[model samples]
Target chain A: MREPAPRSYRAPSTALVPAVELRGLVKTYDEGELSVPVLRGIDLCIEPGEFVSLRGPSGSGKSTLLNILGCLDRPTAGRYVLGGTDVSALTREEQAWVRLHHIGFVFQSFHLLPDATAAENVVLPLFYAGVRRAERERRARELLERVGLAHRFDHVPSRLSGGERQRVAIARALACRPRLLLADEPTGALDSRTGASILELLLDLHRRERLTIVLVTHDPGVAEAASRRIFMRDGRIEDDARA
Target chain B: MAARVLRRHPGRTLLTVLGLAIGVGAFIAMVSFAEGARRSVVRQFETLGTNLLRVRPGSRARAEGVRPAMPLSDADVRLLRREATTLALVVPVARRTLAVTTEAGRVHRTRVDGTEPDYARIAGLRFAAGGMFDATDLGTSNRVCVLGVTVARALFGERDPLGERVRIGPALPARVVGVVAAQGRTTTGSDLDDFVLVPRTTFALFLGATEGYSSLEVRPRSAALFEAARHELTTLLRRSHGLGPAEPDDFTLWSPEDTIRAAEETSRILGALLAAIAAISLLVGGIGIMNIQLVSVSERTHEIGIRAAIGGSPAQILRQFLAEALLLALVGATAGVLLGVGSSWIVAHAMQWPPSVSWRVVALSAGFGTVVGVLFGYVPARRAARLDPIVALRRE
Candidate 1:
């Protein structure tokens, strides 16, 4: 490998730089003496500003793949490059730093802190990133307003409806201005009408900010809305389609 | 954030705080006991003029502290006055607590002191009105007395106590010939102006209970000659008493500072016992905090998952819980210190001693609580930080 050029605010501008590129990515969990392989050899590349949906059956390992992509879990045998950084080789604390700056996660059931105000939940990532108090709060307010939760800043999760809580979670995911956004069934617990509103809000952010997104869901209708879609079967990608 | 977490479980937080406060408070209050006692001893002894010493008939192996002092006679006083060149004054005093009844039948419990005129001058007593009994009065065994201002007021009301008669104990009637001026309050709570004094010659005929006088109150001419005075008195007493080279002298000498030291030595044992109890209490409180924190980590596993998922590192999680523990312990320790200091003040007031708060103990106890918070809080915080993000999130 040749020595790389010193990077700047603008990422290396090769003609077509991929936002996320994984090669032969594999993950295995050791349960006692049994080594359970979750992901087999998998190859995928996502370009910047693309909205990609992942859909599969329950045991198809879509969630595991998303976890690996989000840097919440490590890949056992693979190279994962996100925005020109080889994140797979980083240490655990370094991975947390990578996730803080490059990866955003919105979970199913809208995992906003139950006792914290909406603004507080939004400021969580910035806190880990060591942002100053005034700056973190300012960013929290701006992000909540962007997610259409401007009036719900002080409300805890219990006071917010399913759609509003999901919006807060989405606002939190964008707190650090992450390069890649990952949603694991962000709308699964909401009714279809509320779910559609959340999907619309995410789409608006994606288009306006040109954020690269990877969303996993079992709903075919949800999968069809993405610019690109992938199908996973038994820990391997079976199909990749572009809209 | 740590405060918010504690507020979510008000009952648990209060329980941990109460445990620590009780421990810290007990420790502070107990240490203040020794401090207050020492302060009162200093105050009490300062009331006695400096360069003064007491010589009694027995050695104070008498750190045999509670034993009664052996008696000294008028002959000892005469021997010191005649032979000891370093001595300024030698006065023999015998004392007893007796109820004095005024002519109008009023009663007061007071110390009846039997001594000559030199006793009044050495004790720094001044006359508010009448003068002390002269040496002529002592040599003649006059039935005359001098009353301290407190007893004079209690027994005489506003009437002139001069030439008045008061009964000592049950029968011996002595006429009040003079009144001493008001000496202010003593911290030992004993009223310095609450006694009556009569000539030692008269005291023997009236009380008639003892074989000889209580002890000799001796003073050197100046502070510079104090050691010389002590040596002179010891040599003269031994020679007069006919002690041989090997025989230990029968008399003991007391300086005011020695009395203060003896009092401190007695309180030292009590101080140690209190410290042990306080240490045990704080340890128990620390263990309680650790056990509760362990339970807290397990119960909040899902929350820990959420924190990690949102970009919290293991170190960050550890710091958060550790801060929570410290916050709890710190609050408890502060409350306990205030409680302990307050209780100490009240006890000192009740005992009529000035309240003394030991600030050193306050800092030590609070610092110990903080250390305990870190020591005990570490295990649970580490366990919380090490949770697997996926499994933690998977829990309900």
Candidate 2:
């Protein structure tokens, strides 16, 4: 009944443009006329299928950047082109459309609905994409299996451990097969071994499917897993390195 | 999806639904019961005459303390019938509650009315079988009586009661000359068909010269002469009772139609009061719905974030919660209708009021619930739809 239900993406095969393109991005929070800038003049681009890790301490504006990249928040001034469409100037509804069709997000908290089973969590994005119920279930099963969570399909988030919850989150993120995958500390809440396994899962997904992944984390061990890493300090990128 | 969300807190949801149900049920029951009472009053009044008047002996204390009130007698019936030119019919009714025995050895206590043959036409008595006591029975003081439909059923259910003999007032045997058609309950909740009728002359044999009739039913020939006929009868009765010019009349004359009309007005006022109370209860129910919905919205703020982050639009979020509230209220409305109808029947029987269930009243009650649902669901749904996704997701 709304927006003609977004269509599926084509994996950006033989595409010339980057999956995410941002130029001179600025995000300012206004509290009683006091302008607190979070992301100031950030310029970045990520090619399709690239695995990138963003890292910084608190107050480094990495979270704001991730939120802007995921289309959950808008930059105060910037031109953001996702899937070759200028989306920063788009309306809030159009932004939601882009988020549904082009971006998949995994959070540190896993952000799985407590009331839904693991398979239902995985089916969420495809449901918003207007995929039919039978196909949604089939794809949920396929993605859950791909994430090595085939056994926990019927289990809710509370029934599964932290690593298992993160895997379900990953399966959910890939439900629509979005061109851009954003993870903000995907393993930040798990134990060291579990966190390492979650990171290994993300890297394995990247290598197996050539899926574009942009993850934010602090552990050098996590940064070690990515091919490229960007570090931010005080609202600006301080370092960029290739692994 | 809304059902799934609501099912998460089953206790709260059920309580909310029950609140709405009570409101709707109470409203429908009040209206339906009032309508039943109104219909009963109307039925009672319909059989009474516009030109009809009732006359009974006045109270003990007199306007002039000198004269003690004398009892009315059969002489008054004869005098009113002979002397009054404007009056159409003068029928005296003698009533007594006594136990009567049937031939089958069954005994039931019922009211007995002693009156002349003209009382039949005045009271609209139609016989199911046989006929009323004739003028010969009245002149001879014959031991013949007519059984009301209720008394006949109680005395001899499904059996022909025309020739049966029933004992009146302990061993005073009277033949059942007729059985009247069924008449419904009165406005005062007594059955209209629970009386036995017999000739006035024969009634004197049981009580050994009982003085007068219990009450008199007077009818004027036409509506135009009703007041004049009442005045002439009052004058004749006063003169016969030896009340002088300075003394007040010894009996009271009033129109039964007027009394029933006043009672009908009172019922209308009571109906309005009930509607007010019902409105207040419905308002309370709506507020309860809003309160619960707002709590649900606040409690599910994180879920809203998850939904929004997963690409559910503001409209979709709004639709989800609004639909749930409406669906819950409709279910309550349905349950309330059953509760109302069930309780109304029980109350109608317990209070002996007529049972009149109107489906229009049911629709109005359920429609009111729908209005209540939509009115309360909008606020919290809008609040949920407008939540900031980033901040909402950040909340624990």
Candidate 1 Cα deviation (angstroms), residue A210: 2.7
Candidate number achieving the greatest DockQ relative to the actual structure: 2
| lDDT tens digits by residue: candidate 2, B202-289 | 7877735555667889989898998898899899898878888988777888786677787678778887888679877877877888
Q: Assess each prediction's global lDDT (C-alpha) against the native.
A: 0.85, 0.84
Classify candidate 2 by CAPRI docking class.
medium
lDDT of 1 by residue, A1-243 (tens): 011223452364342878999999998889999999879988999998999999999878899999889888889999998877788877766666667767889989777778889999999888887788899888988998898888998898999999999999999899877878999998899999999998898888889988889999988998888999999998999999999
Q: How well is each residue in A117-233 modelled by candidate 2, as lDDT tens digits? A: 999999987777678889988998899999899999899899999999999999998887777899998888999999999888888989998889999998888998999999998
Give the distance in Å from residue B386's predicted Cα in candidate 1 to where it truly belongs.
Answer: 2.9
Misplaced by over 4 Å in model 1 are: A1-15, A132-138, B58-71, B95-99, B107-110, B126-129, B158-160, B169-172, B181-194, B205-209, B222-228, B244-251, B268-276, B283-285
DockQ of each: 0.42, 0.52
Taking the true A–B contacts (Cα pairs closer than 8 Å), what share appears in each candidate?
0.59, 0.48
TM-score against native, each model: 0.88, 0.84
